[model samples]
Target: MSMSDLFVFGPLAEAATFEAVTVRPLDGVPARLPGYALTGAPDADPSLVVREGAVVEGLLVSPLPEAARARLDAYGVALGHETFKAQVDCEGGAPRMAEIGAPKAGASGPDWDVAEWRDGQGARWALMAGEIADHAPPLSPTSFARQKAMIAARASSRLRAAATPAPATLRHEARAGDVALRLDAPLSGEFFKLATMRLSHRRFDGGRAEALPREVLVGVDATLVLPYDPRRDRVLLVEQFRSGPARRGSTNPWSLEPVAGIVDAGETPEQAGLREAREEAGLQLDALIPIFEGYPSPGSSTDHFHCFLALADLPREESWRGGLDEEHEDLRLHAVPFDRAMSLAQTGEIDVIPMLAMMYWLAHHRARLRAEAGSDAA
Candidate 1:
């Protein structure tokens, strides 16, 4: 253990979050740092400005292990925090205080509450912090912050994945002991990430499989919403140039697909579905229906999708204009009869899997949806 005393003026002050990060009990005592004012982003790290006569209340932890202190320093560095010395009132006198970082300008708030943060975002953040620490190799400061920005979405993905029932293929592995994780390193890219790992698992023949190096693209979870107007017997679809199929040298890069978007930070799949409907097709979803949730390519990707069959009103005039211009989204909307959409799905005119799946689901449940709308109209 290294003899280092520290002052936490933010989320790190919470005992549970502190312990989770440092992997040791935090025997922190309430203390105050004088000559500083408290301010920072809510649910994130905090900052302190040196202000005469201003005092910030925080926790004072001392004599942390060298390793733990080093990890904490890395996290702070990644988060734009710089270390400074301050006087913390502990043991009825001034004690040496190692502050995390320098204060940020342009954005500041009132004193942060450890209790409120722990109550609201603590669970997911704790899990994400640990995971990020585990995979973080010393990256450039810019990369580090960018990676840090993704933790919320990562936490959401993990939580949603946890709530899902294990698939049939995964059931056997679930019944057995946890597969040995030879590696779990995450590599970040511009828009996605790659998790590299090597592992061995029990074989069906009661033998261990050889450890093999593997990599899978770690993707953000997304929402796919297919809009259907039961009263009009029409569905709204959008055509956009898909980069993936284009990269594969497909003759046609434009894909006919449903309204879709990456689940935004702190937003649920249902929220994303509705927002995407409005953004992509100029249609507002009234009520939603979940159709499917699955990994698009589990073998080599972590692209999980929450697919929904959205009930909406699609006006004929709105079919030509859609997609946010700010995102350079050149989307063209098409409003087709339900049968035409189904025929498109059958004839391979629809190239997107989510569109095909939703069309088939609508085919199966069209009668009931129509009847429900009729009753509501009556």
Candidate 2:
């Protein structure tokens, strides 16, 4: 197959993101696409639209390798874009025929800015593009599009993992080449991905260990909020059917737990916590106090929890229902006294680990919180 040029005016125009999608090095020259205007918004890819007398300033990457072209094609298809032949005017040269990916329906939005996107969503997009390339040969582009949401969430998870600081004071400072990944492949599912990997890591004794096979249940970061009414001395708990317990063949699959939801691709953990507080229980939190931030089960899954104690007003109410209809959540909200919640945890009634952890956290800080409730209102 002959290599073709690609005219990029969007996030792909950024050197780092473009490099991630291509296997071979390709030089890009300044180019202009006449009669097409670029438009986009935050958290969305740039789009091209036909506009008379308009010129889109972009980069013309020449001789994109066949494999790289396939990768880009999968990416474009997943984003609802179609590849088309176009005439690109290279700097100081006559117009040349090139391939461009544009929205199938000619979607357009507000003005697009590459610099603004590069500073924010670019890192996650690049990571997502790499994963798209990895799974495209076995998984069709149509199938890949169906899984793009979860893929973006997973990419956001990776981006967070990279930026998070891991203090090495009590642990060994990880160095470059300490862990070498030999193999990584998808194992299952669309909503929640499962993957198997073989990797080798540095041993405690300063020796390199042989690669070991491991299966991981890939999951997005989530927020767990235990809403506490400081003035009323009560906490709000949500009761809902849990699939994990059902899968384990438990007699009672319904669980009593704190409000919880996934940290979306573009949202911060705190933002997710507040949103979940309202979504799961219809409560406007006064304040959110951090309780925990770590993996629930690091050995087997990528489920990290950002637990918090949400201070809110809980008027005395019998069990009431809440939760988003779209999520199929039939949640029953209970306003129980803080002491009673602790008793439930002790009696094995509050079986959810995150809820129990948050209850204990609230117990430890209860006195101070109540004492300051009058002044600490948000």
Candidate 3:
């Protein structure tokens, strides 16, 4: 019988990560694969691809028990990777055949840094992978790779929320122990994911309710910042075409909004707010005041929003366009006075929910902010 040996040149080479993901101790020997190199992008883990005259050192985990082999194969399939039989050198130049993933299209990065990723994002990924593996049966090796970023994005958001310290109210019955959460995969995905889940929770009146089957949209945790200059009584808003309104049959698809962006994995909402302010309005924000941390739609999605009120210096007249070209964002910055903004709000000219909320919040707090600025000036 042939041994089910696999050569791991990436994160799978780490003993802890391997065991955590594969559910087995990584018993292996130091080996080297000739004529191949390990490369990956910032968003992807290392992949071994053909690089002539390059010898990549790795670890060989072989003789996998049948069940474990099946799980491993499924993992590779879900990750959009494939294995090829290759010869590697081990102790005293002895050779062994190991399964390695074939390389794909990407600019080569540094040799895989497993520890760096571990300290930064390993635990969250481990949690996400384990959840996915539990429901991952088996799949064809030919399945295309997708949803790599989405998985990390969703995992990071979930982990962050878990670590966030918040006060609990008298609704103790709607607590962790009172609810059961389960994941049932609809399919492997890309930027968007639809998770079929069973949510059984305790009802009010000290009784248990029926377990409900639901779908969760695993969207990103994002930030939306409305840049304001309290002294100038002005706000910087961006005018851009939005798909949601267009799809909803709105005649005017070009909507006015504040600087906004998706909170990248491992990035704070504050960081996102500042970055978006620069990107969407070309203003370096001074102070970030968090308006709220909330879900866009809690009933059917995991999309989170960390709304902010960013204080910035807005020039009254400028010809500044913002947004990333790669993202196809053609935005115009509108530095409108606070009164005009309020008028727009009342007249329904500012229809986006987040923008409307920010305008109102500013309306309530504008006087205090200006007074504080005035004090600081003095």
Candidate 4:
């Protein structure tokens, strides 16, 4: 069915979420429905529950697809036990209606608009609903409500993509000396968006030198990397399926890597790295040595993957499974000898690039790390 046939009055009425519906002037539309009143300006109006005597009014739109319908059902509209039926107008027009729990007795409000409701807590809920629609189908209002709350809590501090600014005009110039590559950058007056991927063309001597259109350049503050020493002889490596690699049709879907996490705002990279080690692998780090501070892909993504070589004491018999319970992480720790770990990296069995780099770093510093561990034990 056409999107125009759907009419959303409450949380779903926001223009950002409901692009099909517009606020442009329309003529001869019906104005009243039982128990509701239209409040505020015509352009950004809201429907409020006035009184028992008042009536709510809205236009009839199109039927929603099964997917959208399921998402809305999961939104838990408080209309009680009313059977799902077609809402027929006096002129013989009808729309599908799923009766939900009715408003509380004597419930009334001076201001109630879908846009405002969405702006507060409803926007997050709606975005989650959309995600659920995309991932899990046949959404139930109860499940949507639960997932909405969970995702909102996890992403509260992170800026939304919509709120961030887009990249502006870019400038490019060639670097001097032996390197002939051009350095492409945003012009002085331009602004870059946070946590977004960007691509730009580089020009040298007023001529186009290179075109970089596929790189994802996002701006990030810091990164955290976790290193595990497996029971002294080996180190723990986590193997998990990554969607990013799978998207590229990699032969190996599972990656062997250390426990890592993003450094939150105002948090030190070392603190975050150690915290992630504890949370992901249940390792209490002895010392965190900074290996390097650099970007993961300087040509593409904005993530600055901070590398850390964390020293930890390993017990041979201890096999406590660990991972953050909230994040649904499935982690398996392998305690293998240092030599075998290096061999895996050489053969490409450990395919993750970051882990390979860390393993190589460990190879050179293994003796020093072991001596430090022995001193700590004494």
Candidate 5:
């Protein structure tokens, strides 16, 4: 089989990402796509649009192997892009027909800047490219498309974990090569994934342990907000059905809990918290008070929670329907006095542990918050 050529713009033109997608680092010559301009946000994939006098400069990678081409095709298909042959002006060579991935419909935007993209999003894209490489072989483009969100979330999780500071003052400090891991086949789902891994880690006694198999439910980082109206001495809680309790064979699976949502691929926890508060309860928070950031079930899942106390105005509405229709959420919002909420927590009526924890935190800070509210009124 004869190898072909690919004219790539955007992050795909970069060496690291190109190598990850293609499974090897191959040299490329500079090329230009005439009568076309690149468009999209700085943080998004650049799309090609028709422009009479514009020329899009990019890399022309030749000798694209079969596997590499297949992977590239899968990537483009997953992104809702289509490949078409285009005549590209190659440096020191005549114009040649090269495959280019473009948006189905012509899109328009500012001139493409590879250097600017490198400065802003290169590292994260590189990490995500590696993830794509790992999945491109086993999964079809359609299947990969369905799991793209979770894959991006996993990559974001990796980037965050890498950048976060882990203090080992009380625990054993991990040395180089303290742990080694190899991922197995993952069970992919629409919003989450179950992954199994074989890992070996150094024991507390400083000896390396044998590799053991472990499975974990991989979930995106999320934010949870418990809305409190300090002046009114009340808090808003949302009641909704939860699958975990239902799967656990509980007779009643409807849970009274905080407003929550998953942190998107590029969004911050605070942003997600505010967005969720609006979507789940239609409340614009006056302020967001950080309560805790911890794992809900660290041993068996990657479900990290960023919990917050949202100070908001709670009217006399006893009950109201809320939640985004797009998400298929049928939530009931309840405005309960702080005392009643705490009592529910104490009596185990509020079975959601994280919400209960937040209630306790509110209890500790209630006096100060109310005093502040009183002071502001004066």
Candidate 6:
């Protein structure tokens, strides 16, 4: 196989994790191998498989250098026994073959002739599937299938740009100087729907719009906080039964997290953080420390999360079981020293990424927190 013939189908294919995996672009014409098919769960589109049967099809491309190949293999856990096979084939001028996941029997190849597939939704889905699979550890068949479905839903979300659009064009655009004048022009191709598990026509500008340069309005959403009391050398975390994780095959669906709540349309992040501290944990925050502001996942989710570090005086005798009666939040609060929280984070007792990040932040900021606590007491 020559450099030009190779094509990656999933997250590796997207070129986002190329540096992490140590794979590089090959310079040559791309050629396709005939007889193989790509298979994945009905929902996820991240990774693709090249299976043997009628004829496995793929492009022959240049091989990765030894170091790059090693890195890629480690990242994909491709080492060990013969889980997959590598072969040589020819593309533009030379012949080459590559290693890909083993294919499943009787799996059907994608219907490329379909307008939506041709426009590149399949490729995008494959990319997303690869990313999710990469992060998640190997699971049982049932669990893997569920993960695949989640990946598909995430890929098909309308919040992200479709796979095959022109490189220079923005998915949604605003005037250069105006962040609020966002415009949604007509989309050029179809969109994949996670909920329906199918490709469908996507019409941009579906809503009534005046012109290219139009005002875009967005509401200020809510903020959630987990407060840590430095003077007492204790941190507060809330435990709640989370249906989302439960549905995703988590063994213990209930989770322990910092205080959190949404910001009303016009409320500020600080206001929302303090309010949640009171509502969920029955404590008032003395000071608020900014953590980070960013989207949880720009590729799949629309929700933006702004995190805060709240310092407060927690009452030891106060009941830990508190939640809004109307919302049906069955919450249990835990107050542990900073070191113990870090130990929990290290042991995987605390698995949520946000919670882990906050724990680490506290580890570094504990001294200042303690000094402030002393000043307040004085």
Lowest-lDDT window of 10 residues in candidate 2?
132-141
Pairs with backbone N, CA or C atoms under 3 Å apart (clashes), candidate 2: none
lDDT tens per residue, model 4, 259-289? 7776653356777777788788777776688
- Every model's TM-score: 0.82, 0.90, 0.75, 0.46, 0.85, 0.43
> Which residue pairs in candidate 3 have backbone atoms (N, alpha carbon, C) closer than 3 angstroms, thus clashing?
none
Tens digit per residue, CA lDDT, model 1, 268-293: 89998888887877676676899988
Tens digit of per-residue lDDT, candidate 2, span 1-378: 547777887777766667776655546889999998878775677778888998898888876667787777766666767778899999988899988887654445787777778877888988877676566344565787677778888888888888999999989999998988643663477688777889799999989887688888889999898888888888998999989999999999999999999988888889999999888898887668888799988999998898988888887956899999998889999999887888999999899887887888887888889888863532
Best-to-worst ranking by TM-score: 2, 5, 1, 3, 4, 6
Q: Candidate 3, residues 100-149: lDDT per residue as tens digits?
A: 76445367676655667777767776755553454355433333233444
In every candidate, how many clashes are there?
2, 0, 0, 25, 0, 24
After superposing candidate 3, which stretches have Cα over 4 Å from the reference?
1-10, 13-44, 47-71, 74-113, 127-148, 173-176, 187-189, 317-320, 375-378
Model 6 regions more than 4 Å off: 1-220, 317-319, 375-378
- What lDDT score belongs to each candidate, Candidate 1 first? 0.74, 0.81, 0.74, 0.51, 0.81, 0.53
Task: Give the residue spans of candidate 2 off by over 4 A.
Answer: 23-26, 92-94, 105-108, 137-148, 374-378
Ten-residue stretch with the least lDDT total in model 5? 132-141
lDDT of 1 at 310: 81
- Model 3, position 8, has a per-residue lDDT of 78
Candidate 3, run of 10 with poorest lDDT: 138-147
Tell me the TM-score of model 4.
Answer: 0.46
Task: Give the best candidate by TM-score.
Answer: 2
